[model samples]
Target chain A: MPYTSDKPPLPETPEQLRVRIPGWGVDLDPADRPAVPRERFDPGATGAHWEFPERQPEERPRERSIEHGTLPPVFGTTLPLRGVSGVVRRYAYRRFSEARAAHWLLLMAGDRIDVVESRVLAAVRGRPDDPVAETGVRSEVSHHGWSSRAGAGRADVVHQPMDPVIVAGPWVLGGLAAVVVARRLARRARRR
Target chain B: MRAMVYRGPYRVRVEEKPPPRIEHPNDAIVRVELAAICGSDLHLYHGLMPDTRVGTTFGHEFIGVVEQVGPSVERVQVGDRVMVPFNVYCGSCYYCARGLYANCHNVNPNATAVGGIYGYSHTCGGYDGGQAELVRVPFADVGPAPIPDWMDAEDAVLLTDAVATGYFGAQLGDIVEGDVVVVFGAGPVGLAAAQSAWLMGAGRVIVVDHLEYRLAKARELAHAETYNFAEHRDVVVLLKRVTDHLGADVAIDAVGAEADGSLLQHVTAAKLKLQGGSPVALNWAIDSVRKGGTVSVVGAYGPIFSAVKFGDAVNKGLTLRMNQCHVKRQWPRLFEHVRNGYLRPRDIVTHRFPLEDIAEAYHVFSAKLDGCIKPLVVPGPA
Candidate 1:
């Protein structure tokens, strides 16, 4: 079943409606852009956490400010993303306008593709007060195809991925290419 | 009386300082009424400034009533309210003749780094700052902007660095009507960048930062669309998402550090981790820009060589422009903007502290506590 908004819907603010949301909205180039499934994404096992690392206290550290110059990275990653859950949660909240705009980190571990949807479900099912603050997602009863998970902990949540979505794009694309090429080679070998 | 002495590295003291008197023909001795702790001043505070002479006064962002002036001084008279240009220029050199006062070679020959400025460092012409009760400003006619009768000194203090830097970014980026501009690092410079971009006719401006309070303020004050970088890992992708597949026409990097490296690390670390002077955000800016776009880096850079892949920038056909803001050239227009109520850089100030409470002020600014954007230091009674 296609996912639908589960909350009481209201009119979008002028800013929200006029906002030029690229990949998610009217400007989305359908050929290149994937259809975002409405069903609740299940974070089957991985639970992502936004870790705010504590900075060591500087008691009386030297305060010399230096002139930082800029060149560019010699061997930096072409990929721009870093944390996985961070990006997913960011998109989930952004696409679903009703969700609180604050940092709602996605915590999930599952199949790479599944985790994306799961993270949004995690935000919706568990985040009752904020209700994932989605715009149109709240209009339907079973927006995620699954009722809210109650006390869903260890059995469902895991942490191996640590925001696995960071590598989702490249990893998924690379695997698909490998499978396609492998199939072609297998077909040639069978014909010979 | 002794001045607040910069004894050595990591050492400065407010000593019983002798009062300064006008020295040069165009000099003016002014009693500093309000001197704020500047982000640049933190360089001297942390003893990061090299070859910095001890016993030098250190505050530069200040407003005061001119107490005395030299024979040649005409623009400012005694008892007139004024604020000195942080970028102290001769106002007559070849560079100054072209309105590039920040690059006045005569005032700062060794200052190949930044044209020249008061209270910065040897690289900035090594003049003492206004942190002291009294400061002597040279080339007074060409540099200081007279405070208007109606303007509040507290609000006007920002014109010194923050607003000037913003104007510089907007000017260099060539902000035009209906343009989309993105300013990275919503610090004072970024906020100023948004304001200036709007003033220059950008149809939409987006400010990216990790701090929510600052983003809120940027949205409220600069009339910009704010993005929380903390929320998205791929800033370029997120920005592209917002700008209809074409990134901002101009992207300004107000933050000037490697991804996780700093100027100090490059200076001291044996076999420096990186070897060319490149900022990580510059690459991000490049990626965040649309085709044939420009990236303006106006952030204060420290002396360090981190390797930058020039090939990528070149191949991308990106035009990277950077310079210490030429304040003298743009100050008149900026000040006019302030006078006419067309600009208000003061909206960024979330905290104000007395000079006596210096430590607390630093704490708030450094910690970014409570939406602290611009922290003003009141040297004396407000």
Candidate 2:
């Protein structure tokens, strides 16, 4: 269904779709559309030599949305699905329609997981993320952070209390986990 | 062939790639001469856009010489220099017939909302971008236009997307004579919008940005008032105070997803990916535009939920207009403006990088280092 010169058959006939979904073909009538005259189906005019484009060789498994019949002729192979986040994203694409909020929310959740994964990876590589500096907390202190908010009457103030938790919550949890791991290791060594 | 390849977020490198070939009868293989790093490409570079797979090249603004054309290609020929619009649309589709080429339903199978775009994510149709030695351009006859004889190549390249999109933004505002127009983000698009606002008979135009260097560019290039939001306590309040408690007649959000006004919005959207885009600038546009005024959005946001002030917009009776630019639609007037010396799209170019050094170029542009404003990538010897 992806990148074929031949138009794919509709999943449902127009009459069936119209009956099942309201406003399914509101723009189907050429009489009502101004561009209808130019929308003539003239394949000869297109000059496409092939029935479908040659598919680029897939170097690895790629994410294809469930709604699509196959992978596009050419797809990005650079960031193949890997780790836990990739599994979640793959599930999102495999199970949900693009129109569903669940599809996007799952992707967002995957992105958050990716952030944590990257941070943990960085720590393992001896370049731990500096939460205070990287989180813009330093800028908040130095760059008119309080004065700008005091009299500005900004709408974002309602969510101000949660800012710290949202920004610093992961770092705090990570620190606690590290301390717990270190203490357990120390106790085990003493028993040995 | 060599091209810029995406390794991951904040990681891109020049790598040897297979030279693109004619994929369809309407396709043409273009030997890229010049490509630009658009502000929106940063969205892909930052991993902000969904489905931005690694190994995908990220470029949309480019100009090149046609190396080979499919048999059916009539208008464009081999050896002709061409400037391709970022939009890949079948010109006969319903949307294209109405000159809304950006929304052409035929080109992209992935999304119904927008036509295919070069070098953007799979969402825009997974067409490879032009930041390479060679690019395969589909719908070649419809999308690639012969550069005017008198036009500079730099100008031609910029016109492909950045300049045209900016001009389109101003045109969308429908600026009347003596209208006070405010533009957010002094990137190439914002600068072009400010300049185009004047051409459309704006009485006054103002540009907002946190960078002093870009604000300086806005003043020198667009000849408009500039405001460093970093210097102001509240930029919206400042706009209201300057406008005598009313707001500008039109406000344009040229700054898309990664706007830096609010710490929360930036962290949540840019960092956490909870929202598709940070709506700080859009909210500012809604709040800063006078009641019943127009808020024109030329900024590119992902197809996801953004925390915009929709209720406020409805209450204020504002006309909100936005679209991916119909690039070729604005070319006639832009060509005239360029010939008349009313606009110079190439003056914004601050750095040029060869294809090999593109990694450094993206780093400089992304980090906003060395006062870099607009950077162009020059693919090697033809």
Candidate 3:
């Protein structure tokens, strides 16, 4: 059987090219062309990608202080302690995302490819001035495919492929569980 | 231990790096004996692939002798010579279960997008590659097969990637007897694909490339017709005319992201790094293939969007099949073909460089200098 996709593939008529793929310049021939105007590097990626939303400005510079919080209600604590644990968890999650996005690796010669912690990569990157900004090369590299987890790791996932399914295995299981719960509730209501 | 590291675009250097160690139960450390620089690696060299981190090494087509095996590695013991597929698959995922090892879900954290590839870039699971003195083979039991006594190391290394990918490209064509196949790109993989198409009962095969040297090599190695796209005003139109105005029965796009075409497309995509390298070759494939024909893409493209003629493809009903070749699935047939003398994968190697001269090797290959088609890299002074 031929493969089919529910989400229609890209379609741009010769005349409607401008309307469909906004910002995609007509010039596609490869020649000695001038540098792409900086504004042309739209993080929004209108042409090749139309569905992805623009990234928040705050996410660009990786210097935001993560407000790591802790539980203030140890034995009924003070005002400052409220929601502290949740904040800590959120901070931890962001750090985890950063670590995943970081290309820091642990390897000997050629034995294998494994990831090291983000802090270790940060230390190495610190010496050379943050390599990202230091390279001074800016292009609208964006998240790939359909990875929601790619949200914070946009730098890493931009070039990689991704499936649209999110936490697919667990998400499916949760849906199944909800269906079962709903069925059980319906049965109880009938009995009552 | 020393290995090639990506310093920047068009810059590479051999540097001392820690040797690979077994980090997983199924991992095995192999001391690389022979490594071939692949055409796709050029994409990395030219800074086409995104997330090609500076420190990352970039050799996927390689062979070596195992020096150590982790506890769970049972198929091969230490001190065995083996060929590892470019793919690092868990062998138990939904994709791997069906022989689509290239789409293995467990190995690469970015598996949602691309499969785990050894030593291409951080996009490929950040696995250090086999261009170094040592490399770790993950899922060693499932991925690395012992070298057949008759197969040469050079041929075995090719099977790991280029040769197999080419063969797979032909297979994707669904070629019937007397089919006319046209391959765009005369690089190593393109040459291999064209040659393999002949093996698949193609009555005619044509290779297209701008470089006279590469086209000559394609003619010589693939024993097929060659077309210099640059010499013609519109190569696609010429292809249709030559194929009786019906277009090719099957078209394979061996050139991926860094394709050169019209001046403006090259500037916007290749030079500007705006969209994934211009979809020139792919568009040509779509334009040159007959309605209801198959177009197989083996070229390496970054995940970023490219402005391809998807609408045309849909309207034409072209069966556009492509993937990073599942190397392990192609192994059985490749081995038989090698044993039967149907293929000599090593015959494509045109240059050899010591590990220390990798920078020069990269430069030579990148510049297309000295009629270079494929170059082999030795891990040590050779």
TM-score of each: 0.62, 0.75, 0.69
After superposition, candidate 3 runs with Cα above 4 Å error: A1-192
- Residues B1-382 of candidate 2 have per-residue lDDT tens digits of 8899765555567767777776566788999999999999988876677766556788999999999998778789999999999987777655666677787665554555557899997667778999998898887777898999999999999999998889888877877656778999998999998887776666668898887778889988876788878778899999887766678889999999988888888778866777889999999999988889999999999777889999999999999988888787678767877887778999988888887766677766765655667999999842
Preferred candidate (TM-score higher): 2 or 3: 2
i-RMS, each model, one decimal: 25.1, 15.4, 22.5
lDDT by residue (B1-382, candidate 3, tens digit) is 8988775555567767778766656678899999988888877775666545556778998888999987756678888988988987766555665567787555554224667888876446657888899987777777888899999888999999998899888777877655778999988899888877766666678899877767878877777789888768899989987876778889999988877766555555554455666788899999999889999999887655678999989999999988888787678767877787667788888888888778767756654555677889999778
Order the candidate numbers by TM-score, best to worst: 2, 3, 1
Q: After best superposition, candidate 1 residue B76: deviation in angstroms?
A: 2.3
B9 Cα displacement, candidate 3 (Å): 1.4
Q: What would the TM-score be for candidate 3 when compared with the true structure?
A: 0.69
* lDDT (10s digit) by residue, model 1, range A84-127: 53354334323422122221112111113332343455358673
Task: Judging by DockQ, tell me the better candidate of 2 and 3.
Answer: 2
Worst 10 residues of 1 chain B by lDDT: B269-278
**Which tens-of-lDDT digit does each residue in A1-192 have in candidate 3?**
013323122223333433322222222211211111101222221111212212212211221112213211001000111133224323333453323322111111111111112224436867332333322121112211133223332111322221112113333676899999999999999999
> Which of the two, 2 or 3, has more lDDT?
2
